[model samples]
Target: MQRIFITGTAGFIGFHLARLLLDEGFTVAGFDGMTDYYDVRLKQRRHQMLLQSPGFRATEAILEDRDALDGAIDAFAPDVIIHLAAQAGVRYSLENPRAYIDANVVGSFNVMEAARRQGVAHLMMASTSSVYGAETAMPYVETQKADTQMTIYAATKKATESMGHAYAHLYDLPTTMFRFFTVYGPWGRPDMALYKFVDAILDGRPIDIYNHGEMYRDFTYVGDLVRGIRLLMDAVPVRPADPADIAPGDSLSPVAPHRVVNIGNSTSVRLLDFVEAIEEVLGVKAQRNLMAMQPGDVPATWADASLLQSLTGYRPQTDLRDGVQRFVDWYRAYKDSGGLR
Candidate 1:
């Protein structure tokens, strides 16, 4: 069994990914900051569940604390390091721009440094589709020029991608950077749209519909997203001797063993349709509060996941209504069991 060290195991996607890896009989070491960004209790619940697996152990520390992070990584001596911990939120970046810089920029540098020092076989980091900012192209592809980032959040993530490429070139570190779309499922963040909408609707509060219900997102299920990550673990990129030998539509860097892949459902669902799916699941009508587009908000985001499929022979195709129903069920059960109390 390979030893895998993962950061942010207390987070939404991290929790799910850790659980999946544990089930596959991998020895896993998890690190998390357990910040009170939303609710520490929810984060605790995620880690608590993972602890049930005897193959799992975790360290609680922020990524900004380089000593702690390095200690945990050094102790694990992992074959692979999946860097998932970061200050994550698009809207919140506007309120605390420095937080994004501290965690996403400086903290990411620490992880890269550790990976290079450890000589890990592979280093995987999470990026976001928001990096494709100001590009009007439909179905965002990895080969497209992603220059015009609109928000601090997107800019920081883009910076990490560039940094990862540089490290891959200089250190010969095999690296994969994933650009994830709107990921949702059970045990999701309270700040996300599906979670907030379900909670507000259940409480009989009006739900905010930004852009007057004119938004679209490539809502990738958490399960599908993590499976993509797992498969890509084996598809490590190798530096191409000749740039012309590279396959078409692949984002692999010619000068480095690094690549960027977008993990998404490949379909853009309208925001209104998503809300209606939630309403149908709950059998409750949402008191809709239409609002103008918030700053740093995009009207639509769709992913071209062909490269992901070609690389891994898999694609994320979970149905929106089915995924929404799963989340609703989990939400009801969690609330009944005294969640958020």
Candidate 2:
């Protein structure tokens, strides 16, 4: 069995990805900061569940701790390193911009250096759809120019993409950066929309509808998002001998063994419609709090997932209502189990 070392295994997407990989019989080593950014108990619970699998082992440490990160990766000697740990939260970036720099920028650099030294076959990192800031283009494609970054969070993620490209070019590292669209599902982060909306509604509180409920998002289910990551792990990018040889619409770097793929549902659901779906799932109406768009917030995000489908032969097709139902079920169970406390 192949060994995979994953960062942020206690995180939302990372936890789901680790569980999936563990189920597939891969020997997995996980590293996490277990930050108090949200409820530490939720993260701890995720780690506790993963530990049920004998093939899974984990180290609790922050990504910014280079020595700890390097030690864990070296001890595991994984064939692949998936870097998913980063200071994640767009609006929170406004309150704590320096945290984004510390984790997303400096921490990402450490992961790249470790991957280079280990000569891992693949080094995959997570970027975000937020990086497509100020670009009004519908169905954002990977090949398009992504220069405008509205917040420090997006800027840091964009910085990591550029950094990954440079490392791939200079050291011949096989690197892939996946841009995730508003990922939501079971075991989702409390900071994300679905979780907050569900939590507030269940507690009889008003749910904030930003942009006056006119916003849109390509709400990619967490399961589909992680499946894309797993498939891309095998579709390793190769530096093309000629730039002309690259396929049309492909985002493969012509000068390096690197690629950036957008993993999303390819459908932009209106914010109001998403809330309605949640209400339907819970059989309760939400106290809607209409408000102006927050700073650094985009009105919409839609992904062009053709490149992901071409590489993986799969696309995220989960229906909004069905996904919402799944999350509602998990949220109810978790809340009943005193997870919300």
Candidate 1 lDDT by residue in tens digits, 56-116: 9999999899999999999999999999998999999999999999999999999999999
Model 2 misplacement above 4 A: none
* Number of clashing residue pairs, candidate 1: 0
Clash pairs for candidate 2: none
lDDT of 2 by residue, 223-306 (tens): 999999999999999999999999999999999999999999999999999999999888899999999999999999999999
Candidates' C-alpha lDDT: 0.95, 0.95
